[model samples]
Every structure is written in C-alpha cells, then in structure tokens.
Target: MESLFHPTGNQHILDRIDKLTPIKLSEWGVMTVSQMMEHCKMPLQVVYGTKHIKVNPLIKLLFGRRAKKQFTSAHPFGKGMPTAKEFKVNFEPDFETAKRELKELVEKFSREGKEGIKVTDHPLFGKMTYEEIDVAQWKHLDHHLKQFGV
Candidate 1:
C-alpha cells in the first residue's frame, strides 16, 4: 500500500493535490473542492493533536475494530461512505487557503514521518500503529483526490 510516510507516495499525493483548482467539482458527494480540502485536514489535525473527536463508547466498542481493519486495509475506500460529523465541513472554505493548508499538512506529515504523529489512539478506530495511520491517511487523501478527478 502506498504510504504518506514514504517520499514517493507523499510526492504523488502532493502532485494530485496541486491539480485541484477552485473551479473543480467533486465527481461524487456534496462537498465542493474547497470543502473537501478542509474536510481532508481534519483527520490530520487529530493525528497532530490539533483536533479531538468524541466517539460514543458504545459505538467504539461495537465498531471500532472492524472500522480500523477496513481503514488500514489495502482496498480503497468506497464512495459515499458515511463521514464522521466532526470531519464534515458545514461552511464554505476559501479555496486557495484550504489548498495551501492541505498541502502544508501533507508535506509536514511526510517530512516528520511516523514520529510526527502525536495521537495513535483514534476515537473510533482505537489504538493504531504508524503503519496503520500511514495507510489510512494515504487511502483517505487518495480517495478525495480521485473524487475531484485530479
């Protein structure tokens, strides 16, 4: 699986992100390009200790392990999957600003590598290793980049 922790994969994702433009529209889903960029940043924020999500204990107990497996698997994320409310962008984001921030986060994620992740215990996915985080992050950004046809 391609991992953001590696230089090649990181550059690939950055190239795709650079292809995104203000006028680009999602091939599926409700989010505009800018909104998607903003949404993408949320998970990274959590990993970097800049954001927190409160998952219901019951939900975590019932679904956390299964969800973690799916997220870290080699298979790509399917379209129209349910998004966590915390990761959803309700307001419009500035296109250029969102793109810039997303790129910066992606770069930082790669540059710092596994040691950069500040939180390994996800609210809904339970405990994760650096490998799992890398796969999950790569899959997520790849999914969204593909969504925009970049």
Candidate 2:
C-alpha cells in the first residue's frame, strides 16, 4: 500500500490537492470540489485524535470488517458510497482554505509516523492499527482525488 508516510506517496496526494480548482466537477456524488476537500479532512482529524466520534458497538460488530475490507482494498471506492454524518459537509466551503487545511493535515499525519498515531476504534472500522490507518487514509484521499478527476 502507498502510505502517506512515504515521501513520494505523500507528495502524490498534495499534488492532487493542488490540481483541484473551485469549479472542478465531480464524476460522482453531490459534493462540490470544495466540499469534498473539507469532507476529506474529517478522517484525518479522526485519526489524528483531534476529532472523536463514537461508534455504536453493535454497528461495529456487524459491519466493521466488511467496511474495513471495502475501504482498504485495491478497488476504488464505488461512486455514491455512504459517509458517516460527521464527515458530511453541508455548506459551501472556501476552496483555497479547504485545500490548505487538507494539505496541512496530510503533512501532519505523515510527520506523526506510525507510532505517533493514537490507536482508536474508527467510527465504523472498529479498532485500527497505525498501518491500517495509513492505508485507509491514503485510499480515502485517492478516492476523492479520482472523484474529481485530479
């Protein structure tokens, strides 16, 4: 897996972010390019321990493995996939600001390295290791970048 912790892989993500424009079109989903950028930050925050969202025990027990598999698999996330409520962006977002924030968060994650990531149960993916978080984060950003054809 291409981890954001890897310098080249990290630059790949930042480059994609740089390629986005306020008027960029999405190949799928309802988010404007800016909204998608903001939405993408949610996972980083969650993994960084800056955001805490509780996962219902039953939901995690029933769907965690399946969700984890889908997220971390080589296949791109299918169009119009469901998002956790916390990750949803409702208002118009400033394109540059959103892009900058996402880029900063990505860099912060890379600096933290594997051991720096605090182990926590993902809101849906259950308990995840730093390696799992690395793969999941990269895949999530890649999916959105591809969504906007970046």
Candidate 3:
C-alpha cells in the first residue's frame, strides 16, 4: 500500500490532485469539484488535530475493524458511499482556494511523517496506528481522485 509518509507516494497523490480543475465532474457522489476539494480536507484536519471526531464506543466496537479494513484494503471504495456529517461540504467554496488549501494540507501531511501525526481515534474506526492512517489517507485520496475522473 502506498503511504503519504513516503515521498514517492506523496508525489503520486499530488500529481493526481493537480489534475483536478474547477470544471471537473464527478463520476459519482454529490459534491461539486470545489466541494469535493474542501471535503478532502476534513481527514487531514483530523490528522492535524484541528478536527476532533467523537467516536461512540458502541459503534466502534461494532464496526471499527470492518470500516478500517474497507478503507485500508486494496479494493476501492464504492461510489456513492455514505459520508460522515462533518465531511459534508455544505457551503460554496472558491475552487482555487479549496484546491490550494488541499494541496498544502497534503504536502504538510507528507512532510510531517509519523511523529507529526496525532494518535486519535477515528469516529468509525477506533484507535489506528500511523501505518493504518497512512493507508487510509492514501486510499481516500485515490478514491476521491478517481471519483473526479482525474
């Protein structure tokens, strides 16, 4: 699995991200291109500790591992998957700004490495190791990038 912590993996994601344009159309899901860019920032915000997701213990116990496996697995996320409320981009976002911010966040995530990542519990997938988080993040970016047909 590719990881954001590795330079090559980070560059691969960045290259994919650069392919996105304001007029890009999603092959699936409800987000506009700009909204999708903004939506992409949510997970990084969580990693950076700017966003705190409260995980319900019951939910984690019931679904965490399953959810984690889905995200970290080689198989891609199916189209029109359910999104968490916090990840829903509700407002209009400036395309250029959203793109720039997401790119910066991706760069920051790559530069941070393991020591910079926060050890936080995912809302649906309990406590995760840095490696798991890395796989999940890359898979997420790949999934969305593919969604936009980039």
What TM-score would you give candidate 2 relative to the actual structure?
A: 0.93
lDDT of 2 by residue, 1-150 (tens): 688998888988999899999889999889999999999998888877788888778988898899998887777787888988878899999999999999999988767677557656777887777777888899999999999998
Off by over 4 Å in 2: none
For each candidate, what is the lDDT? 0.93, 0.86, 0.86
Could you give the C-alpha RMSD of every candidate to the true structure, in order shown? 0.7, 1.3, 1.3
Q: What shift in Å separates residue 94 of candidate 2 from its native position after superposition?
A: 1.2
Instruction: At residue 64, give the lDDT of candidate 3.
Output: 82
lDDT of 3 at 137: 90
TM-score of 1: 0.98
**Colliding residue pairs in candidate 3:** none
lDDT (Cα) of model 1: 0.93
Report the number of the highest-TM-score candidate.
1
**How do all models score by TM-score?**
0.98, 0.93, 0.93
